[model samples]
Target chain A: MDGEQQYIKNVDADAELVDRARAGDLAAFGELVRRYESRVYRTARHILGNDEDAEDVLQDAMLKAFQHLDSFQGQSKFYTWLVRIAVNESLMKLRKRKTSRTVSLDENIETDEEPIVREIAVWDDNPEQRYSQGEIREILDTAVASLKPIFRTVFILRDVEELSTEETAEALGLSVAAVKSRLLRARLQLREKLTRAFKRKGDQILGYV
Target chain B: MVTCKDFLRELGDYLDESVDPQVREELSKHINECPNCWVVLNTTQKTIQVYKGMDPEPLPEGVHDRLIGALEKKIKSQA
Candidate 1:
């Protein structure tokens, strides 16, 4: 693995940095930012669907994490704590969007009562490998961008960030049932969306997926 | 034999293996016997796998510098 890969993937490595950071080591805190800034920025970027708002959230979330360093209990991994802050900040940004096309945080939970089961399109066994990384990134980003904020956030937290259901709930102020409901739909929803994007035929458009 | 609705109801938990053993077994059996549900389960799993495997994109140019510069300025002022 590359050095940058090790820097972020080693969650355990953040502990000593956090200790130094708490002791007024600004450089250590900067190191912590180096480790997580991409992740935190991407979480915001994915949630907000634009760079301008995401940049604002990244700065705000990092600044907030720095100012509140003393409150970090260390019971959980430091990365998750950073993520929780970034997620909350992203959600706040979502709420404040002035566009006519805004999804309320509670917008789509009614699907929880009776989930939709469609005629799913079976994808190629390894659709991801068929595309270059940049192509896959664009495909997935467009697919995720199509989801409503309600389902999108849960899917991002649980699936993307790999947070536990309970932690996802706590991060979003949602119940476990709510998180699961949204995540299921998000998965199924993305499956359907990506099926179209991934279709080798490229000539058909239908709801089967 | 678990009904498709029953299988769908327990799917998220089934994927997480949080369902009761009996329910999980039923869901597993149902998927084995059912093509449509199997497709749903398989594609859904793959969808998540695709996303989880995506690497984090680097921040836009100057974003890191701008953020760190602003923070450093703030800290310096407070000191």
Candidate 2:
């Protein structure tokens, strides 16, 4: 079957599972958790910046989702609803800490009247190939971790999880415009981080040659 | 004609296909003519693609089992 047909099939299956779980079939709920656990955990990990906290958030969110299963109106996908709970749980943890890691939406990338690429070396190597290197993956993780929470979460939802802009906005309770703006910032910041790391590596290679 | 500034501002919307058709056409036109903007857009797109391609860290086996076990216990207690 094609992608759309497969998606429909999955949705139908999920709906059945939701109905069963809502009717107090714990096994059905376990199946739902199995399907979504990775996604929920990853979102929480990105938001909370650690495994222990993310695991806690994951468990808490799952329990809360189970307890409130009746309130799930099916207006959104079950996965989206689950992610919203996970994100809220993660954010509550962040709020408990005194340090607020918020990115300014007003922060703008400087643009020239006539834009010119000055120092950006053309990266001709296959990014997919380069990404497989352990060091590169480490750099990516650090770069993503460095982003302020708001932008990082938007990036994780839109880029990492591959959620649609509308779904991301819904998940975060933000406007589409806000999601777009934050996503752009996140991409730009990540690009800058990766570029700098690549440049440093290039310089080191040159020095060793 | 969309200037580089306008293009930068709306690049995300253009990429997302969320902009008006006319604006998208204009942005496409600008990118076609502007090498710098082209590189910026290309690299940014590549960055997202690379990030997407990375494998998600698997949930540890211990944690996975514990989570399931805990949920099952909670359900039983409530029963």
Candidate 3:
């Protein structure tokens, strides 16, 4: 039998943590929580734009996932399943605040002329290489936070969380076309914003931080 | 010659590699001669690369203790 895909499969492995977790193994479940908590927390924070709500959603999602372990049929990735729950929980929090960013399907928010989309300024230094890791994190977090929620959610799913475009579409209840359209706008807008922040010889970048 | 607008219109699909071969060919040609268009393609690809490389932030101080404590309570109640 061709068994090259396994680096030698064992009965006990990280990949089988979900199955182990399903069998009422508390340690297994705890490990799964540790593995995914940061991602779940970040997804919540990104959607809700705050720490307190993200922490609540994280707790709720882990508890809910633990309670309903039987429903996780092992078809999709466990993290993806967990993230779907987290995203929904985050959206519920947004709705309660009366400012749900995801209530609509159509994202025609901009007229496309006020900011020139085509004239992208190439960075003088490769900014990722130029900045410290902490600075880069702040820069990216700020830029993403500035995006319209409609686009930010799509970018978070497709780009940050590494979900497939179709998976992102399904998660958000958006069409694949809408996902692509929103992702395009998100990437373009972030590029423009980052360019302004990092363009050559510019003291202009310093003040935004 | 495909206008910069034409390239911008198909930007998403081009990046996704979902464009028709002929249109893809035209876009490739347009990007070769168009500095502004090239900048769009370059910087946008870089933006996604940078974000995707970011490590997820770890749970903040003491949050893990509270979460696990709550989970343990729920598990004990189930017993």
Candidate RMSDs in order = 3.8, 5.0, 5.1
Which digits, one per residue and each the tens of the lDDT, describe model 1 over residues A69-186?
A: 9999988778778888888888777766755666566665475475676546667656656887788888899999999888888888889988889888877777888888889888
lDDT, model 2, position A134: 83
Off-target runs (Cα >4 Å) in candidate 2 are A99-119, A127-132, A199-209
Give one digit per residue, the lDDT tens place, for model 2 in A1-209. 99989988988899999999998888899899989898899889888788899999999999999989999998888998899899888888887763655433233434322222233434556554555578777888899999888889989999999889999999888888778878887887887677665542442211100
Arrange candidates by DockQ, highest first: which order?
A: 1, 3, 2
DockQ, candidate no. 3: 0.56
Pairs clashing within candidate 3: none
Clashes of 1: 0
Model 3 chain B is weakest, by summed lDDT over 10 consecutive residues, at B35-44
What are the iRMS values of all candidates?
Answer: 2.9, 6.3, 5.6
Put down candidate 1 lDDT per residue, B1-79, tens digits, no spaces. 6887887778888888789998788788889988778877887788888899877777899999999998988888888
Task: Give stretches of model 1 more than 4 Å off.
Answer: A1-12, A99-108, A126-132, A199-209
Quantify how close model 1 is to the true structure by its C-alpha RMSD in Å: 3.8
Model 3 Cα lDDT, one tens digit per residue, A1-209: 35544523422354488778888788998988987898889988998889999999999999999998889766666777788888888877877786634444354666343323833566765665678788988888999999877888889998998788888887777779778878888888898888776666532222110
Off by over 4 Å in 3: A1-15, A99-119, A128-132, A202-209
Docking quality of model 1: it rates as: medium
1 or 3, which is superior by TM-score?
A: 1
Residue A172 error for model 2, in Å? 1.1
